[model samples]
Target: MLEIITNNRKKATLKYVRAFLFFSLILLILFMLFITGVVIYAKSKGAPPLAVPQSTLIYASDDSLIGETHYGEKRYWVPLDEISPAVVEATLSIEDRGFYSHHGFDYKRIVGAILADIKARAKVQGASTITQQYARNLFLTHDKTWHRKITEALYTVRLELNYTKEEILEGYLNTIYYGHGAYGIEAAANYYFGKHAKDLTISEAALLAGIPKGPTHYSPKVNEDGAKNRQQLILSAMVENDYLTKPELETISSQELNYTFGSTKERPVIAPYFQDEVKRLLASKLKLDQETINTSGLRVFTTLDPELQSIAEEQITQTIAKDSEIQVGFIAMDQHTGQVKAMVGGRDYTESPFNRVTQAERQPGSTFKPFLYYAALEKGFTPSTLMRSEVTAFTFDDGRERYVPHNFNNYYANDKITLAQAIALSDNVYAVKTHIFLGQDVLVNTAKKLGITSQLASVPSLALGTSTVKVQDMATAYSTIANGGVKQEPLLIEKVLNHKGEVIYESTPVKKQVLKPEEAFVTTHLLTGIFDEKLNNYTRVTGRTVMDQLTRHYAGKTGTTRTDSWMIGYSPQLVSAVWTGYDRDKTIDLTAEKTYAKEIWASFMEKAHEDLPVLPFRAPEGVVAVQVDPDSGLLATKKCSEKARLTYYVKGTEPTESCIGKAEITNEEAPKEADEEEKKGWFKRIWDWF
Candidate 1:
């Protein structure tokens, strides 16, 4: 029994030893697995993260044409592929030598950096590897703290697991801010080089690469010596990393830095007046918000000809003159295409915010007479139709007042002036008489069809520009006549392209037939004669004195409203409308020997006509120019001094009879009869009898 019990004890001891060994191996394996899992999880969490839809940078075409933008700051981001290899290598060497090899944190480098810091006992230590720094810049704020560092480490691990190395570097390069309001490598390159990131030079690359450490402290523009020293450090790293040979480094170190920084924000300063119009048109057409319209970085291709724009600016500046306090607005367009080539809203863009060209409504004065005359022409009144340019009156139903029409000189010759002669002289009485004969409704309708959308009073005085209209609308009106009766709404932006190079909007020319080509041509011919005619047989009139020295014959009309002066003229190549007035409409001191209105017009025309070929107005298919008596507006005889006239070419359109034979008062008899009648009036007889 004793021997069997001893055998059982021995067996039990052997089994106990075997169980202890197996349990020991199991615990050791579990311990290794836990450490491995922790390391893998930490590294997975360390990867640098990225947010969607990064803020993009926008640029203007040149330094001279910029639209106002309200961005956080202008930044032009360059893609990773476009950046120079040297730029990337140099930045990596200076910032993080172990960037490629490290998962997110480089413990070896961090320890060495800390040791070096302890030895130096100075706060100039940066142990952050390129990957770690990228992680910090991307996910963490700039405030330094142990707690933040711990969080940065966790994020670094996340970044390595989530994103690729190349992506982290890209985000690092793009997201980091360099001082001087720049936020990316691309912006820094442009900010310094006045060129795109793809256009950066080697020296420029190094200069920017050195900015991330201390953007403000070592900015090349602010501290050249500090930048140079920082740059030398980076160059040494590049040499050590085999990015550059020693010889290349030596050569680069000796070269002078020819960096230009303020050149960075080069944006085009385009026509502000046209830009404003574009915004308005886009708002109405595209139904866009102001924020989107202003900052879309949209590539707008306009119909503006650069040459014409320069000419227009020069013309306006010359016309308004540096000394004049008057503001002037002008716009010129192609008669056929309706392309607005040149426009100026005010004398100086910087001085004024008021856009007078498309705004400000003032009575267009005698310039309004053309619409009434055109109505009469369409109503079977030939250019030679007889009209009385004598003092005229009308009694209104309100019993308020009767407006007697008088010429600009406050004198009226009671002669039977032909329709053409009356228009040429811009006689108010003749315009009123013709307007009444045709009816005021006819004139208003004709004017509206000719692109005059301004409100018109339902009275005969409407013929005298009693209705106020803007310069742009007036330009549209005249352009219709110049365009041979097709009304085209003026356009500014031709197309808009988005950041990804997608076209968003393009303009299609919108045209509407507003008048018969024949009517339009007849009006053009009559207005042309007003400029071409020599004052003969009509009373020695005081209106615009005809200057015969001009070699070219073009159609134009001048106007003087209560306080505004205007000139709307057209040649074969361009149509120009000009307005000059004070902001608050004060009657311009016409006492000045030469009123500013005419001088402004003359100056603008002289400059505008310089490059434009002297092309004559093309009369439409059925129109013809013929010579007639300026006084009688009839077929000329040998006795007529002003025998030159332009008559319509249509068959049956010519005046068959001479006004010399038909008129009740010849030029000589009318003035005498008017004086005799005036002598018999109550006030006149009292003065004469006394």
Candidate 2:
């Protein structure tokens, strides 16, 4: 009976052994087939299906960092040589102890992880080695499902078969994600330690290595205690792997490392609106693919002046009442090169991301008259040409309709006014008559020739700038005038380079001599008359309100509508345009809101030109400045009024005669002895400018 029982036990043990051997052989065959299929697919497809995404960095013209643009993952790629050895060792120890030894997976480790998952009744434990984890990150998602698991396994086998172990490791280090918009070890090191990846110490390396397990939990900025706990585990793993000694581990454990994020230090974008415009230009004007801009790791060198950009932002915030709902758009450009130097969309980017300078289109008001007057110059009208600025209704469209233009407060000169006086006063009636006499097509064609792309109706009101236009386009047209009538497109980026520092796109200015240099000089001189009180007639000059705030010479124009107030001006070096009003075009009634544009423009232009030389506007050849009487429009002589003004004109266009000598001089019309000295002082200032 005892022999029979023992024989029964032996048969039972043999049956269990047979079943285990059969299953093991089937599993081994299946694994071999999977590896073969993965190798075939990897070879046929060339590289892995995943491409390492890259980040783009933007720099100011001074070669200082401004900001960066990226997709969801912001990665700054670095080679294996750029990474610290401590970081590599620490990462290997904590992430995959047998990374160098295993092909891509560790079978024994997989078994242990499976057992642990089964014990916990959850899919928490993962047996992904460094290569496996990297393969999963590059090729698959983190979802805990059978489909993703199989895909990850396939990619792991493919990576081990096709790439060298070093290559796989380098890619893994570059593709790993850290918290706070940083991906890859280099960006993480710079973000957390304020240093480069190659400069990280052992403690920082260990701390960074532990972040991959759970970025939310192990990030030092979020949870320092949890990060420290995981850092200790990383250190212990390094010790066990022979990367560090027990004594060194203890020393590192007690050491406190400084985290850049833990302090008050912050690195916000220096120029948000400027960088945004750069992005738009890259995609829209340069015809670069948006995807390529966000991922090709472009290095964009722009024309932004950081100091001027700061001043512009400060002016907008400080000049406007903070609690008011008014919005503002401003732009400053290098008139010579057509390079945009500074820009601000609205008061704050956080509150409104809409790019007003580039996107918003509102009525430009009388600011559009420069193009009209420029067109008049292109035609035969000189600065001294006379027109009447009186109230009149014009019949257009074959005299079927009437368009009556009104001046501010219904005030009119009710007499003859020169084209120069008209521009200085922004007289609507004079502008309309000039617009009509020159034929409406001439102004429209002239504006289009300069830079204005917005549609013009060719109606009578077109002279008064009734058409809605972009502030940037208006700036571009004025830049052409400021550049002595040389037309060129506005540019934001100077050059763009690929990740390899190879130039991809470069700007070559295509300037066209659209207007005569002499005519442009005369027009610019006419604009300067706006600030001179000598040109005052029925009303003060449009720029008179803010002229006292200026310390240097400037040629500018002010435009006002029921909803928009504009100030556009330029010196010899820079050109700026400013607009202030409600966003929804509501009527602006406050006296303060009405004057915000000119005040901001005056203060900003002064601060902007403080460091620049006090250079006068250059007068081109054939353009001569002649002293004349404002009332008579003739050469200034003792027979003229007490005030004598210098006005610019083309060589042949100057008045050929002097004012008729007054038979009798009265005290009211004649200057007192002291007033004569004071008048000389004012004329001397103008003489010194020449």
Q: Which stretches of candidate 1 lie over 4 Å from their true place?
A: 1-68, 77-176, 185-187, 237-243, 263-270, 282-284, 294-296, 305-307, 319-324, 396-401, 535-553, 591-594, 637-642, 649-651, 657-690
TM-score of each: 0.76, 0.79
lDDT of 2 by residue, 312-417 (tens): 8888888999899999999999889998889998888888989888888899999999889988887778777777778888999998999999999999988777
**Residues forming the 10-long window of minimal summed lDDT in candidate 1:** 52-61
- lDDT (0-100) at residue 429 of candidate 2? 88
In candidate 1, residue 101 scores what lDDT?
A: 87
For model 1, residues 210-239, the per-residue Cα lDDT tens digits are: 988888888988898999898899988999
Lowest-lDDT window of 10 residues in candidate 2?
Answer: 681-690
lDDT for 664 (candidate 2): 52
Residue 9 of model 1, lDDT score:
94
What is every candidate's alpha-carbon RMSD to the true fold?
8.1, 8.2
